[model samples]
Target: MRTADSAAEFQTAAQWQSWLSQGSTFPVFQPVLSLETQTVFGYECFGRLDLSENVASLGTFFRASDQTLNTLQQEVGFTLAQQVAQFFSPVKDARLIVNELPSHLTALTPLELPSTLEALQQAKFPLNRVVLDVLLEPGFQNPLRLKTVMERCHSLGCQVALGNLGSENSQLDLIPYLKPDFIKISLTLFHRSFRDRQFRRTLEQLGRLAENSGSALLIEGIETAEELQQALQLGARYVQGYYFSAPGRLPAPLPDFQKKLREALENFRMIRTKRIQRQVTWENEMLLRLVDISFVLFEADGLLRLNETDLEGLSGFIHRLYFSDLNGFQISGDYLLSETGCQIDYRDVGRNLSLRPYFFDHVYKLHGRPGGWSLSDVYCDENSRCLMRTFSRYVTPQAILYLDVLWANFADL
Candidate 1:
């Protein structure tokens, strides 16, 4: 065995082919556990090589073999199957997940199986127990070829899984057409796209797609408790990553695996519940504070006639204020707060508010109750382009005060 100074030391494609042909490559299994059953759903097979000291990473090894990717991948697949057949023979329930490139599928002759499939068959392993995890790569020439391969694999009692989903190489738009039995979402996407609304929407859409197509969603690369919770919340049926266990020999039943999973879930729930309670409490307190201020204004004038000046003295979170009559007719102008000063807009004045849900449900319905006030759920305001909540209260016999509170103030709660 010769040690290379760096990955670039394997300069030529021949060097890579020579390294792969030396038969030093072997498979390591990573358990994909079922969240529902707390048991091993399957083991994903990753290829490891007996390389010289300075190889850097397996990724570098694969990159050097780009020119002969198909050949190297086929060799790896066969080796992995043989290893699985030997060591993982007694595991009847757990599936074997083997990765293959899309282009390799195109090279297969009709009605003929790949070397890995043949090897598995020779070992007397049921085809259904093997999942061909397709690694989406660039330069995929033919969709028809890939589809044919998938159909043939299915006919042979094998299952297909689309791996590295949400990664740059993954063609998400082709998911519907591929219709894999499983979709493996990469962990990197969660780190990058968690806070992004569009990406979250895409994730939600993928979840729905998996559900509708009868495909199980597997969230891969989960390496932390938070990541595990996120995967569970996103409805992943199977999860795999170092958070559970690193890739190694066949894992025995982890006695405390279920305990740790349940603890993480409980912690997540507690934190979420506390946050919601805090938000609700904050909203209630703010509304009550506004009610107190309204009473002060009423006592000062002996009549509740709120103007721009009156609203200016209030909290900055109050965006707009107006009053409605008992019959749900607007009686006051819209007093709006601005960066410079408060402004009164009369555009919507004299408009009927009777049909408004808040008017009938809050004011008219709960009019006579003591300290009667209704705070609406957070909603986007079209004019301000900000989240807001409307607080409505009966200030006087003839008037109902409507206060628009900026939801941004309590957004983080």
Candidate 2:
């Protein structure tokens, strides 16, 4: 509640030292959500205090005297971290990301803080689960020292996650090498521009990297459905914000609701995929025959021109694309006629058809290839219809194709 100018009273050397020695005033837990399971994953640690004497605002107080406050903040962070470690006891697997300025890691010599390390060890919590979330606000002065500190943290079993990832400059490059377990994007930047086009792209790129590097993306400061939706769409594996839940609740009996929900969702997903696979397998031979027939009737040059018989056969082939065991089917007579070498009287499957891509994406790309004959990861298509694809290659066009497979029997759902 105090500003930088009013923080002078609390900025004295003795008072500051006393506050640091006294440790954190209070701590708050902000929830983070899991993308795959849509459940509460973990909480980010934040300070909650009404410091009347020293600092007006937490941010300003923390930043006013950088040289001294940096070390104090680290101490504060470690104390709160230990508290969190104590809170999630027995099965302390959930991540606790504690914010610490880069200056803290560099300024406070680890050699001098034997008590801090000892306290953490005595806490009986594995260091790896306690993520020291380093914010890239003021940035780091020495990359080598930061890397060394990060390595030391890792050596001690603690993990590091780069927070406030907005710029794609030097800091972004350092993440791949550091190979942190998680990445946190600031909601301020993510929500700016209504929908951050560049940020979304960056999220996608980072998400891919995280996937390969075994890291997770946590979108922070999410307060609205629109932001949450956008973050999820961009492949953020985890989210931290007010939309899912806010910070304040004390550690209570968190029911195993998330576990049960995940199990149910996973079960349904498996069932859906299994059903699609059965149908795809059933149509395999028939669909293969259809492809062969289309190739034979059209020939190499036959694709350039179409006869009445060819059109009829193409129509039948397209029809077999659905009924023959494959999933997706588009009923576009006009577009199909113009695109393919043959003519067809079937109705337009529509240009924006969701199943249309799967129809081609799966079938042609998968023929005889390992795992290609099977249906895709059973996900709902754009049309709100359940669809999967079989990828295979055709000898005629010498290109891969997907057989859009659809399963409309949602009576079970």
Candidate 3:
């Protein structure tokens, strides 16, 4: 509970020396609960200073102090499993989650058990009962070293987690390679993203990233019912916070049968159903509009022949409309809609688009399945930096038509 402002009291020369000595710290276990079952999935271990009322986290202090205390920090975590191993003897599926920092990984030998983990095992705690919450900062580390260390953890039968997802220190680039069993997003980062207009968009991306990595989302620091709901909405299966129980529980407690979980889950399901309904309606309306656009293009005879009058009822959401050949080469000018109204742009008339998945995949996929259109995943156009999706269909015998729609086109959820 000690604040960093008062940390000066512990920064004295003698206190710093005391920090290097043993018995200065011990482990506190915070429960990570599964919202679906409302049960304890695991308990994340923290290194807390063995001080009286104003006790502080050793992990927090060492991290902020830029000290070489990774070894001591990890010792506290392993002690949690050792000291509390008897508690989980009844809970066959319970795990003791621990931090394995970047420095720890770098110091480790390839495919070798970390010294603390080795000690934890000697205490009879199963490696499978350990979830190593790993981290990577924005700065680059030796990729080969990380790979070896990660493989070592996995090979030893431990579940590895990538922590700090969505935070400033989050290294999203390393996620695919690390292939963590869980992607841990802190509560602070998740709440900060709520204020962004693109929060939903970013959430979808995070979901996809977790999906592609075959990882479950583990969101922590959940302190309230609303926060739990938000974490659930973010697709987090495992969550931790004071709302369930604070850290330092000598023997981690059992599931307390929280009514809050049931209520949040029911609300989550209801809200999700309504959101899904809205998406279905949006898709149907947008598909109809695309068909109407195809009809307009047919009625106009050609791209250049189309004018502002041609976009009469469809200029609202359409960013641009163009025709491309089967091989994905644009054959016509764009009927682009602007704030000033629709205008024709011939700049990209002969542009090659064979490599563009939006164009080529649409044409190829719809080869036999005619009379239908394809809607692409929302993406940011690097040129304009606008969120866009391509709706493509064959409007002419020799060319396929594409309508670029802004992401704001009713995917409000």
Best by lDDT: 1
- Candidate 1: 10-residue stretch with minimal lDDT: 295-304
The full ranking of all candidates by TM-score, starting with the best, is 3, 1, 2
Q: In candidate 2, residue 14 scores what lDDT?
A: 61
TM-score list, all predictions? 0.67, 0.54, 0.84
Model 1 agreement with the true structure over 273-301: per-residue lDDT tens digits: 99889987987778667755733333222
Which candidate leads the pack in TM-score?
A: 3
Deviation in Å, model 3, residue 247 alpha carbon: 1.5
> What does candidate 2's lDDT look like per residue over 1-413, in tens digits?
33234334676556766644443355567777676766666667665544555432244445554465554655655675576566665534476656666665666475643233445667876666677787765445576777777888888887788887764333776677667778887656676635544555566777787777778888787776566556665667776666555565354334544563355456555766886787667567546754454422232321222234544444322312211113333222321322344434343333333344454445555656633344444444554344433333333333223334333333222
Q: Which runs of model 2 end up more than 4 angstroms from their true locations?
A: 1-24, 51-59, 63-65, 78-93, 108-118, 167-170, 193-196, 253-413
The backbone clash count of each candidate, in order, is 0, 39, 0
What lDDT score goes with residue 411 in model 3? Answer: 49
lDDT of 3 by residue, 25-122 (tens): 55667878887788778878776655454565555444443445445445555555565565544556778887766766776666456655876777
Q: Give the clashing residue pairs of candidate 1, or none.
A: none
